[model samples]
Target: MEIERSDRPPSRVNWLLRRVMRYFAAPRLNMREDYEKVRRVQRQLAVLPGPRFHALDVEIISADGDHPIPVRVFHPREQRRDEVLLFYHGGGWVTGDIESYTPACATMADLTGCVVASVDYRLAPEHPYPAGLEDCLRVARLLLADPTRAGIEATGEIVLVGDSAGGNLAAVVSQQLRDEGVAGAKRQILLYPVTHWDHDPATSEFASVRNHGDDYRLTNTEVQDYFDLYVPDAAQRKLPTVAPLMATDLTHQPDTLLITAELDLLCDEGEAYGAALERAGNRVRVHRVNGALHGFITLPRFSRSLREAYDVINEFLDERVPGKDAEDAT
Candidate 1:
């Protein structure tokens, strides 16, 4: 069972976390090293089996013009060419790759009964801002243009799903799709998405001691460090497209499933974005997973909550994609 600190005041949690921060609080932002650490942890977690999904590796072009972005696509146990999903990985836009995110892609494919393509965009402080965004858009367009290449069905719609930084890319790519007047992706799934560069003061109030499970954890400092690596260039902070919360308009985008973590710093932005979408008259579902922190979806064994989180994701997908539940059973 997951422990709950809801009864306690935020100050008490902060005080307790201070003593333990050294062990859990990640180091100062060293984009490369921190990125590597995340990949290593995810690699260890991926070894454990959860659901069955097939995988394949492929390549695409990065916005940097010449660099090739390696990608991995996950196909469900029983799938037709009609269902498709474009997935972007979360690694503070620094270290994550298709391999590091295979477990998640596989899990999503199984749950959603759709083919999932996980993109390996160039990381920040190297490729930086618009570069990664461009890579995401290019791949999405490429996938939609040639459905057969990704085994996408002629009748099915494309869906965009992402976590953390990748969630940011998914949002931008979805918005761009609308802007381009292309209609293919029917919806988007954002997992504890980072919707804004500006960390609202209210959200940061409970920065310390947010754990996905007793074993897998993330502290307030770690969140800030990730942002630093992701948007190292101070100037890019004002761009709303980089952070969806800043987008002038939230309407006309696809129906959205916004997941937020109760103890996470990004929670506020995610919830706020959901509210914005709802206010814009768009269909939206905002879910706050209690006793959880950012990155919980990636750590299933360390915490039962992670697996439980996937249950919510699966349910949401089943609802969005009718007949998914029946297909998953078989």
Candidate 2:
């Protein structure tokens, strides 16, 4: 069970996190060192318990077969058929992998009755920008082309789910699919997604960045560092795929469910995205998780809130995807 603090006191878990992160603070950092630190933090997620979804590991082969992408697929042990959720893990586009996100993917598969494919996309400062996004799209396309191995039918409804950097990729991939005349994904779920690299408070009017930007798990300094590492080029950051908020067309994008943590710096931009999608004539839902931090989905301390967030997803999928409820009942 996870604790719920209505008072929200900067989240004791997150406060301690801030203290732990201080040790790694430096100007010129090592990529290996950063990955090690994040891996240590991600291991904590293994301590949390949840429903059992049979997990499988396999390489998602791309066309030309130069390099295989690693992916973790979670299928409900009892359910024979379910929708597909292609999940992209978030670590500012640098850290985090399928193992780090196993619990969430397993829970998502079991709870939503969706076969969850948690992609281990390439990271930044090593693979850099577009590499991760490209890997994500390739996995989506390959799975859509033939999902049988993952226990999903070829024609099953697919949804894209991601957090932070992964959310950005999901949004971008949806647009790409739209442009390419692909009609597969029906919905996208974004958790505290980094929608834009350049966010102007005056223009966005999202005060969360100013109010809860610091002392929280995700700070302005760290955010900037992420951009420095992943998107070294300022010009590339403005691209629609890099920053979906800057995208000109959201008309044919999948139905969107954007989740924002009240205390997260990215909250405003995330909320702003929902409105933009709605204005573009797309069905959108933005829910601000009150008194929550950015990475609640992975932290055991926030499991109560995390569970609620999963419930929110359940309800959303029930409404948008259709047939999910019937599958769950069985």
Candidate 3:
């Protein structure tokens, strides 16, 4: 059941409309079929025109040397400092690669004027939990140690960004960094991140509302199923490292920008995490985009709220670390 939307101006023209069209036009598939469909859509996205910026393809050796992780680095046309963004793309931890998030990464790099490194981490049901987290941390350590490789300062601040499962990774990595006292990532950007494994009915209601009419895309059942595949053991829920919102301490981490799709099942959890951050006295800005659904960030064609999302994010980056362009204009 999708959410009943008010007949007003949609805050943005993103996937909500397209998915709604699909919901009516296509037949609802079973979990296996849905999984295949997701893959096909992702494959289509892998070839789209990504955001254009100064870019380089590179690889970082795993800290443990088990394998080398590939990363795509996007720099502002004008080099500025050691400041860089470490972005992880969301694909429910099962799919998605550097190509899947190309557009958003490109846009973020160009808009923020910071070198953006999109990490292609290990996926789950094959690699499992900490495998992805480990890859992200290893690459982060490597980047912070030498941001200058991409013309960024070695000691410059690093910002972590992710959407959906990628958002979960961003939170996990930042928390780990805080524990180790790794500096530079004073901020994190979460776009409709899934912060939990629990799927109670009330929250399911929210998911239904988020996709009330458009059932072709993400559904509440699908969310639960994905959790099953990624986490598997319910016992893992007790580990805050695994389920970030379940973590006891929220203090000492960098400030956060949490974006939620008002119609997304993950919406409530995202807000809850932001609230927790606020309660801990950390700076937090939460934006719930009305008429939007999960994964809207990737659908630039239907994203009426994309610019708004970009502004909210850039504003946060601006206040924390002023862009070089601002300085030049002064």
Candidate 4:
């Protein structure tokens, strides 16, 4: 499948921004304090607040029956759909939280006309690997069991949505639900998901890692650093739970709308996962945003790439039956 490309040249603003980020925001995996700095930076980046809306924060028990997990529910001004979007924010499993992702969640609810529930799962270097994954799974199961638990009045479908590392969680949770023979999300939207374990250009199978790894907003060094914190055991990184692309069986998963940014290091692997899903006899649609970087979904509402992504996402949500055959849109 051929990915769509923009005829327009890369934005000068983006180029300049990347240069600035390359120097100032470069990952320093030395101390635990460095992670806090990353989180602070993420919070500061969310300057564009969303339109006023009703929001509530709720605490739900974790899957382990031990701790409580925080979830934020956002209600759009006008409701157009009965579905609830279970969102997981991306911060490489370390930085992002409900507060940092509030603007994006609010905008998502308003744009899609679906109540958005953002999961504030446990982060890494403190709660590594399966801890965060467990929190996410517990929330997904609770919502699927009863939508009203999260104040979702509408008893419609529960769609799993996530970007970057959170996208990885959504995919894994969907698969785990299916494996457990429980009700799973009928639809999932993965935005530039981390589907593979390796990001090193020399070792990675995807060309995007080699082509765009160093120059974009998300660098290979930073991603590796995140992985180091999230999963210190390198051998375990290949597990299906960590890297969905490494899964031996991709069958019977949720209907998927996998979107990737053309310049993202994860682009090819995300698209490859979509292809694997299609080959495994699942319904899938893959769209690539040209000239965009990873994490574009959280950009300001006025961002062109952000607008283009939501358009595709909305179209996917509006489909009554997305069809059985996989589609690669240009």
lDDT of 4: 0.87
TM-score pick, better of 2 and 3: 2
Between the candidate structures 3 and 4, which one is better when assessed by lDDT?
Answer: 4
lDDT by residue for model 2 over 236-255, one digit each (tens)? 98899888998888897788
Residue 152 of candidate 2: its Cα lDDT?
Answer: 52
* lDDT (Cα atoms) of all candidates against the true structure: 0.69, 0.76, 0.72, 0.87
lDDT of 3 at 161: 91
| Candidate 3 weakest lDDT stretch, 10 residues | 1-10
Instruction: Return whichever of 2 and 3 wins on lDDT.
Output: 2
Predictions: Cα RMSD each: 6.3, 5.9, 6.0, 4.0
Regions more than 4 Å wrong, model 3:
1-37, 49-53, 77-82, 149-155, 200-216, 321-330
lDDT of 4 by residue, 173-226 (tens): 998998899978889999999999999999999898997777767878888888
Q: How many clashes show up per model? A: 3, 0, 13, 0
TM-score attained by model 3: 0.81
lDDT for model 1, please: 0.69
**Candidate 1: regions farther than 4 A off:** 1-22, 28-53, 62-65, 78-82, 151-155, 200-216, 301-303, 320-330
Task: Show model 2 residue runs off by greater than 4 Å.
Answer: 1-33, 40-53, 77-81, 149-155, 199-205, 320-330
Index of the highest-lDDT prediction: 4
- Residue 154's lDDT within candidate 1 is 42
TM-score of each: 0.79, 0.82, 0.81, 0.91
Pairs that clash in candidate 4: none
